[model samples]
Target: MSLSLEGKHALIAGGSGEMGYHAARALAAAGCNITLMARGSEGLTTAATRLINEVDGDVLTVTADLNNRLSIERAVDHAEESLGPIDILVHAVREDVNGYYDQLDVARLQMAAQTLLIGAANLVAAVVPPMQEAGDGRVMFVIGQDAIRGRPLGLGTCALQHGLLGLMRGLAREVAESGVAVNAVVAGLVDTDRLSVEIDQIVAHTRRDRSAVKSDLANGNAQRRLIQPSEIGATLVWLAQDEAKGLCGQAMVIDGGELG
Candidate 1:
């Protein structure tokens, strides 16, 4: 089936990052009005301009830190003010994670909870109510292996992913009658510039060579290669389209069948 998403408006959080940027580009090509939100204005401007040149849609940029709920709410309002009510909301934002679970402490947990898990809730709250009035909406969170299975050395992250999954599941039920669908896209070992950090964590945990760790992850998938960011973007695009209205409250895994 073809995805023709014209006349929709989308707000992509963390729109300057690889996953978010690619998703924005895909959404723009699908003919939706695009609002790219990120903490820094530099990359957002670059991404918005590049996307504008590539697709026949409006690309707007908003700069705000996700850790700030007020700022997140303000950005949501700004996007709606400029682009109209957001019919699609994709959250591709994440915080930098390093070190092992044993090293975690109260301060770190609180920060992660506030910046990531709680921040996501704030954004969703700000974006969804208006959707109920409009009678159609799609909300998607881009998560990783940490959410589904426990990360060996990244337990703290695993916890947050679990929290996000819980939030999505709960929201999915609450908004079902409102004609809104809430779901997640679970990706694993995707080929992004940030993969180096994941490799580092694996190496530090397994005491293995960087090359060995990288190859192991790449070959872990049935496809024998790292999943591309564009693949994730494509999945997000599909889920937001009208044809996918029946798929609600689900985690569509895009990990090349890594977990059977």
Candidate 2:
């Protein structure tokens, strides 16, 4: 029941996005210092400013490219220097490249993989080792449902998610005894700004009403509504707790029973 992360420092990669922002808010509210990292300086600044007002802990923003290992390293170094060692790492970076498996653009898929999978590897290489050395830490990957079930339009994302799931499992086993837990949150149809944009795109292409398109997405889940961002945020907070060590390498599905 004690989920107080009072002295913990968490680095949320891709922290500018809706999902990441809410996760940072939750972690900060639980008394953890937060470092928001993303490629866009503007979004980082805006997110940090808002978080500073809403949360009790300190918020730092680092503008870095996920695809670049050096950039990730620099960001991590700066965050550790400013807020101490990162006791929790939340990987929520999303690449918007999608195509059918049969007609996939190899180049685009490769690029997406570089950012989502390789970038995650780079982050883990930099962050997890330290946690293992210290013998305490948590890593959570916020990914999509395509990882568990193939989506025809999300070939690239599906590939990346599967790869990330593998990475999480392998790393969890490698570091389990060291007191570091690695897991993933498989999200589905979450109510986010990105989802809204996606819905708009579908409406424009299919000539459907905006409400109809949104309703279709929401209806994909049994709850008949989009998953709230706060729900995902709360789940991340729980997984970050010391007591959740038993959840090693598991993919916690938070899709309102959509997968069912």
Candidate 3:
């Protein structure tokens, strides 16, 4: 199916980060007016400027901490005021709390859940009313492979990510007839700047060589290589298009064959 987002407005949370930045760029290129939301204004400004230089469309940056409901609401209001009602919502915000169950503190676990699951729910709630009234919208959560296949080291993150899947499924069923489609993309090890830093930390903690760590991760996937952030971004752009209306309550995994 042809994927086109002409005249669409998209709001991407965590849009200052690696995967989020690429996703925003792809959506903007696909003809969607983009509003990128993040916690810090510095990264948001840089990302927005880069996207504007690359895509011939409207781009706005909003800074909001998802941990606070008031902040999220204010950011959504600012985005709506600047770029009309958001026709597509991409919840890419995630707290990077990588640790074994024993190492994870209660506070960190709660933060992960709040950022990954609760924050996404809040964003959806803010946008869905208008979308339902208009009779059209798309919401997607950018998840991780651990959401499906739990890893011991990813306990907190996995729990939150899987919870997001359930959230999407329930919301999708609730809004299907209203022309709102909710889904998720479960991504694997991607070669993004964020991933690189995460991998470095993992290697240091595990006491493994960088090359060996990379190889071990690659071996889990059929492609035997790290996925590109741009690839994930492209898939999200396709999912946001009108032609993907039939795809709802689905978790599309782009991990090569890792989860298979």
Best by lDDT: 2
Off by over 4 Å in 2: none
Expressed as tens digits, the lDDT of each residue in 130-162 for candidate 3 is 999999998988988878987757777777777
Candidate 3: C-alpha lDDT = 0.85
TM-score of each candidate structure, all chains considered together: 0.93, 0.94, 0.94
Q: What are the Cα lDDT values of the candidates? A: 0.85, 0.88, 0.85
Q: Model 2, 149-191: lDDT tens per residue?
A: 8765677778888888898889889999999999999888888
**Model 3 segments more than 4 A misplaced:** none
How many pairs collide in each candidate, listed in order?
0, 0, 0
Question: Which candidate model has the greater lDDT, 1 or 2?
Answer: 2
User: What are the per-residue Cα lDDT tens digits for candidate 1 across 1-260?
Assistant: 77878978999988998889888888888788999998889999888888888889888899877767788788888888898889999988776455676677657767878878878888888889999988999999988777898756666778888888888899999998989988899988888888888888778777899998899888887888889888888888899977888988999988887843
The residue-level lDDT of candidate 2 at 173 comes to 91
Per-candidate alpha-carbon RMSD to the true structure: 1.8, 1.6, 1.6
Per-residue error for 202 in candidate 1, Å, reads 2.8
lDDT of 2: 0.88
